[model samples]
Target: MTSQFPNTLTPKMVEGIKGFNLCTFLIGLEGWRRGLTLKYYSDINQYSDIHTQGKKLMGRNYSLQSKDKIHYFNQSRGDMVSNEAVRIAQSKQKTKDYLEKGNVNILPSKEFDKTHSDVDIIKLAREIGYPVIIKPTYGSLSKGVMLNLKNDSELTDALKYVRGQLGYSNVILERYFEGADIRVYVVNNVAVAALRREPPKVTGDGESSIEKLINEKNESRKDNPYLAARPIKIDKELKDVLRKNNYKLSSILENGKTIMVKNKSTLTQGVDLYDITDTVPEHVKQLAIDTLNALPNIIHGSIDMLFDGEEAVVLEVNASANISMHMFPTEGQPRSIASFLMDFYFPETKGKSSNHTNMYFDFVDIVNTLKQNYTNYVEVKSLPQPPLYAKKYIVTGEVQNVGYRNWIRRQATKRELHGYTKNLKNGNVVVVVASHEKEKVDKFKRVCKKGSKKSKVSDVKSSDWTKEIKMGFEIKDNITKKKKEVDKKYINELLTELKETQTKLENAKKMQEELRMERDSYKDKLSSIRNSTSWRVTEPVRVIGGLLKGKTKVKN
Candidate 1:
């Protein structure tokens, strides 16, 4: 079944998958599940025939091939996204104009080029009204976005910071709209999900200072998969925001008080996401759908808006790349946007079970594939001979724990062979070698023939190793130390399991106690009702009624 698809696993694919970008990984996973041959092409390694001109390539791009048809993707956005749409989306001014033409409510904005003077910017700001936003026309991740510039002086300084420090040539001034920062993801003219994004903030615990509280919050962010690596930065902008709120890092906040740490709502900048797909108004959803339809050749995109109760104003349209906030939302139900995208890309695969857990590739295999490709790339660039030769050697001798594995690793590394040496359970050492040069593999095998000083090499069996192997040489230990480490790991696992069991037991006991208390309270209520004055007063009536019922039964 695997051989039915084209081999898309290459060196470039490895580099693309090794990053912290969840979107890229998710896309790769989706493609793999959908039966598409996914390949990563790294420009750095000169894989996929990318011209580097002796310069190091620094990034990896992706391609999904379905037989004869192939689709290229960068990040989450794919070939479906038009270059014109991307250009318009990159410019805030263009996005606003497009939204306005579509009858979507948009904050009034004025565009400025590098040639624009500060006076011209201030004039535009005055026209837009006070408390306007100043931001780069073509920027992302909330970088170079300055909110609520009240006066000309503030705008002047912000413009200088954005232009001089941030190096943005184009800028826009728009009326600041304060409300929920919501992002609606639309695919194929349909709104799939929506999320309300909140800027990074901390709640007061009464005891800890604001700075301490922020630090604690940042530490807690490490638990969130999306936020783990990206912590909220403590910078001048944050301090300015605090000062504006009449507080500082040293200020102690009262219990239950909440303070915003950043001015903009950007997930990369630690913004929190709340899935509001089910609750977002139909009109808002329609607005997002309309916004996407307004732009040509945009099969999928995200519409960032500010919902100010009365209306949802389109803030920007992101067509080039957008975060998958709906997938890993901080609150509310997660939406399967990846599945939706896959279905959109391959409509015939819709309704077929593509469970992510069941379709994942082996991590080690991916790493090895990448390594082999990289080795080939380097050999092509630097070595005179092509590097595609590989061999696996199994030696039966006194090789267990005699440092034979390390010796094999040194030998392979010296020849630039990418593979690993492991101690087999049968007291034999298995060494795998992968190289483009045949002599290198033969040389490595010859070196393995003479066992290390502490061991004896009885027989060396060699075979062609055509499978992908890891980069560099690695020594796999099956000695007492490795066993001890494994034992320790199991012990930790057992301890964790015990702790979880204990917690469940405690919760069960607490629940049992609450149930008993409720049962007792109900019993007491029954006893009180039986001993009530109403019961006493109606006792003779009850006796008379019983006698009458008996008489009626006898007559019948």
Candidate 2:
């Protein structure tokens, strides 16, 4: 559509021709107020005057003669046209011109293509290449845009499926661009705000199962605007994607780990958006504007750009873009979109600039702070002298029943310190020692700090006694002397019994060796005797003759 301001005129004529007086053009008034200009107030009052007074600023010849008079020569509406054209130009790959200067305005009675088909879009993509985008021609936001189609088969399959489901054949197919998607809002030929959206994520707690967590998230989405409208449904698409990542709904998630469901950070999908305005360097802003200008028919529209590093590619533009912050507000406040519309209506009032000086931080406060707290600041100092006179301390906890007393005893013995430790009645350790070396005291303190593994130091009370102590360390007798006497007597008896048993065992071993030697000697002697007997003949008296003689004697 042609701008109310005529484009045929020279720069001088353009400047001389007045726009809608502040009162008549609502958008223009909005621009001035947002522009932070004092002239905006003057213009507002002037419009109010025209409503009340008969006088005119430029006399009656000017287009806006009175409050009711419409200024047909204004270019406020041209913003929408220029924005659309810039988008188209960028999508068509007009890089340099779009960057240098954004699209100015659309031609008179300009119209976008109302009907487009998947088949026609596919042809465009195939001409562009295998990878192209297929989206609805008349889509809201970025619905129905797909990427990375390698062949006609996939395209045909997708085309047939969407057409059957949505019952709309007018789908937009454009060349696919790979990179991070960006959203930038341009108001009245100037970029107002921009943001880079990140994909969705879920962090793991190491305890909850992914499916349980997803259910919880879905439940939460019932209250969250970003995820409320269309709850994230568990379907074949999500299942397939999850399966590809080796993720099962029942899988336990590790703590601090994040899982991403989709590639884009759209409210309809699962994704997170991190604001990048602070990090968006100067050059990037120019590139975005350039990308927008390439689209010839877009004015007052949002341009989505895909960027890898500094190299940006123009994505689809949204003509009737939703004031997105409704679904997701920016950092702090909900933006005043109505005011933005008012600015677009009043274009001429915004040209006047405000000269208010902004106050910033001063250095006097820094010096004052230093003076107040300078002594408290960190400073390097020499180490303090070590403790001069060493004192023995006995500290214990749940040490006795847990064999901690023995541990302490062994430690003291190893150190050759004069001290003895024993378990107390109330589960405390009582130790006494006389040591002068500072190093030993330090070492003992160190050991006390880390007590026995099973023991907890509930209290450690120490005192310096007035009574003179002996130098040599000894295991002092217990207050119950009878128990100590019994223990000592038992130990002596055990030692004596062990010695007697050991002597008897040695004697028995010696006798066994001696007997074995004697047996061996006898065997040799027997062998010699047997050899001598074999050599000699044997003539002996018969037992039968002796028996006959004995019988004869009996008979006599």
Candidate 3:
């Protein structure tokens, strides 16, 4: 919604922020509504908040201070500190103190015993009992965690796994909770967003391999900031889950099938964060605020919660929560999280709700939704490049006429770069551009390679040429011949192979079915054998005794 943040910081970081919707959240709703521009103040060495931009425009500053001694510099109002710092500082606490408070609740936790080895963890497990959780003392976002320890062997495995993952010298073990996890975002003693996040689940197609299916899911999340945190790994746990479900990695899953590889709501477990904004009842919101207030130095964080019926337990609180992705929800678009932050930061805006509301509805909301979906919706125009320096970019592969060329044309024109895209007879795409401002041109070329859906660019070559073109950006007519379809002979051969593979698959299914029947038949016989004491003890004992005595004499 807001203009793509200019190259205020390093381009990569800016780009990263843009991709993750971080800058969008920072700007807030009022910023969007008023057409608040993000400008790089050449005067200050650091990034300024909303006020500095206003000062540059109005040729003055709006200053104000609060009871807490935090400063805000503005255009109409000038410098001073505010009371917000005091509020933020009040809610902070040391991680150790927070962990020690676990005794307040029945759930178990411990300080890492510095002198203890893996064996000590085992001893602690025995004392505490089975099915415990092992985690790192200094960790965030479920970085180093393990669950489901049923016995001493499993405890050892969990400890080893946790230690290896964290590379930590010591770790804490706690009781594992069997319930849904919720993250409640609290700001100023009120619950803003209460989300119920679930581990990612997918319907099986009864054809593709599990590994293949996982690849598809992961790739689909390339544009998702949080989903990218989870990487697919095949380990013993994955195998164990398959075995427990009576499935093999080779087994084809049926449609509408769901599988959970990990239990926790961590991104590594492929978490699906649901927007329960409307669903969170009043009591639940109060409970979350109450839980945070109970903890020290814990404002502006997410409460880790597990609820059973009406009862809920607070696992922990995260100070630096990633509100960007959570704000721009995948489903059920709610009020902007940025709106809350802006109003919270500038308390004066509280009384001006009508003004802010008009801006939000009139400008910010609709424009942001559109820009988020398509970055190019707001075109950026570039300044002219001089003859001394002309930038040229050559891109190859299935890029031309597949929407890539059009994208390049738009970006080049916006950034004020002069470029031409053409299709080669060999089907490769070549783009040449000359502009005075090369950085904008370079950015254009970069975006061109990663164009919209359906553009599959493989190779790109860029260079600075002395030659310059006076004309503005233009889209040259470029077309490539389509590849020939498979011949009849090849098609027949492929069909035959497919039929053979299908037949083999059918036979494997039949074999599995037969094995199941045999297993059930053997299970019945074993049940009868266990129940038949007369045959098992009396008959067998007598026969064995007679054979032992008579066989001894017969052998002599």
Candidate 4:
């Protein structure tokens, strides 16, 4: 009934697109879908570095342009968002100070540096009153943020953790506000979406221990693209929550019982974000928009707040909020956060192109190339413009392993096409090619009908293609299994899932056979017992005893 978190993250989860890279991808994809030329670069050599997985990945920069309109971005922070805006959002003290100066309601707080010792910090807390929160003045996101310290003991430990352990010299001590913590996303002065933030928690099903429940939740998180990167870790914060609630990892949480496992509502710690876009009070959303405007050089992004009683108070303004979270909320309908961002940056592209697209550039491959030292920088292949002519050829009969895909790839390359040839799981060769000339696409159908030299083609069925296609033709086979060679993780994920399913099916068959054998043994033992003289001899006595027992319990 109990379990351990194998680990916070899966082996391959963190290696793929994540964090800032993910944010930039979501936005860039939106632009790419809109028929814009989107390119992913390792780094332009004039940006900050993002440290992740032991390697310092320089700014995952990208750009979206169509004609004279172009926008460069370092992750989600676009070039239009000034460095001053980033600095203000990054510093806790500056955020509160600027909001107050703008007459925006903020929690009362005071800031301090290394000059203030532990005793000095505690004295300042007493002056500010109990039930306060203290965090680093600069970094570590929510790791050092401690809320609801009702006494000196909790405050002292919080101070020690942030200052000593975290080594953050400058810290801010603020009165912890009470209410539902939420984040409101404002775009172009519009309160586009709102979501409530809650500490990571799990509801009991009565059959599972708290630990088992946590593991199950973690498994489900692996399915979510946004949640998969961050995990519900069993750390000191989780332990403190369990201790306070008188629950243990082995404790069986009764059905319908919900308990918070982590204090801070951070995605890194498995915090949950629930979309309340449609139902949140209009006034609260307006307040979010006003607070966002209070910050200079920032026209949009998320605003952290607390709905304290009947009113709302701004906690912080995000200059570069991860729009991916809004696009993929844990509950409720997903908002068009990425679309709204596109509208803000490129107003001319509003409602011009279809929302759906099958084509996507390999952003991870670009970053991998940078890390692998293949290149210090990679100028990603530019996406093609719209009004493209596309077609798909499904060639069957001795197609696979006969260089059919390679031949098709060569033919498509010769035609100056942009697409790929792949071997289908059903032993068919599928070639999808696109070009600006419809005549070329129609002409390729005749070439595909002839088939390759070693291939005996039974049929060649062609269809008109409307979905998006990346620029360039390549053959996808065992030679191209590298993650960098693929555009999306969908192919790898599907293959791995299929392999796992096959293994599970084999194991299931073995289990079923074992159970069948066990059932036969039980049947044989029962048959023996029924055929024995003892069973026959006890039959009459057993019937009489049963009759008597039934009469005694009967309520007539």
Off by over 4 Å in 2: 1-130, 150-157, 218-227, 263-267, 291-299, 326-339, 346-556
- The TM-scores of all predictions, comma-separated, are 0.62, 0.40, 0.51, 0.77
Ten residues in sequence with the least summed lDDT for candidate 3: 1-10
Highest lDDT: give the candidate number: 4
- For 413-475, candidate 1 gives per-residue lDDT tens digits of 776777788888888889988766788888777788897889899989999876655445678
Better of 1 and 2 by TM-score: 1
Model 1: runs farther than 4 Å from truth? 1-20, 43-60, 351-556
Tens digits of lDDT, candidate 2, 330-445: 23232333244444645443432221001111112222333454432211111112122234556755666675666666676666554456556666676654344556755676
Descending-TM-score candidate ranking: 4, 1, 3, 2
Worst 10 residues of 4 by lDDT: 1-10
Candidate 1 Cα deviation (angstroms), residue 467: 24
Cα error, candidate 2, residue 246 (Å): 2.5
What lDDT score is found at residue 27 in candidate 1? Answer: 67
Question: What tens digits encode model 4's per-residue C-alpha lDDT throughout 501-526?
Answer: 99999999999999999999999999
Residue 63 displacement in candidate 4 (angstroms): 2.5
Candidates 1 and 3 compared: the better one by TM-score is 1
**Model 3 C-alpha lDDT per residue in residues 1-556, reported as the tens digit of each score:** 1112121212222223332234232333233232332221222213334223312222122212234433332321112212232233222233334444533232576656467788877877788887887877656557666666788887777667777655865677777767677777777787878777776555589787776777777776554444555555556667676787786667667876878755555645666666776787676677667665655544445667776547676666554455654544434443344455545655644533222221111122223434354322221122231222455667777775678877777876776665567666677766776654556656766675686588887777887754324235666653323322345657889999999999999999999999999999999998888789766668778888999999999999
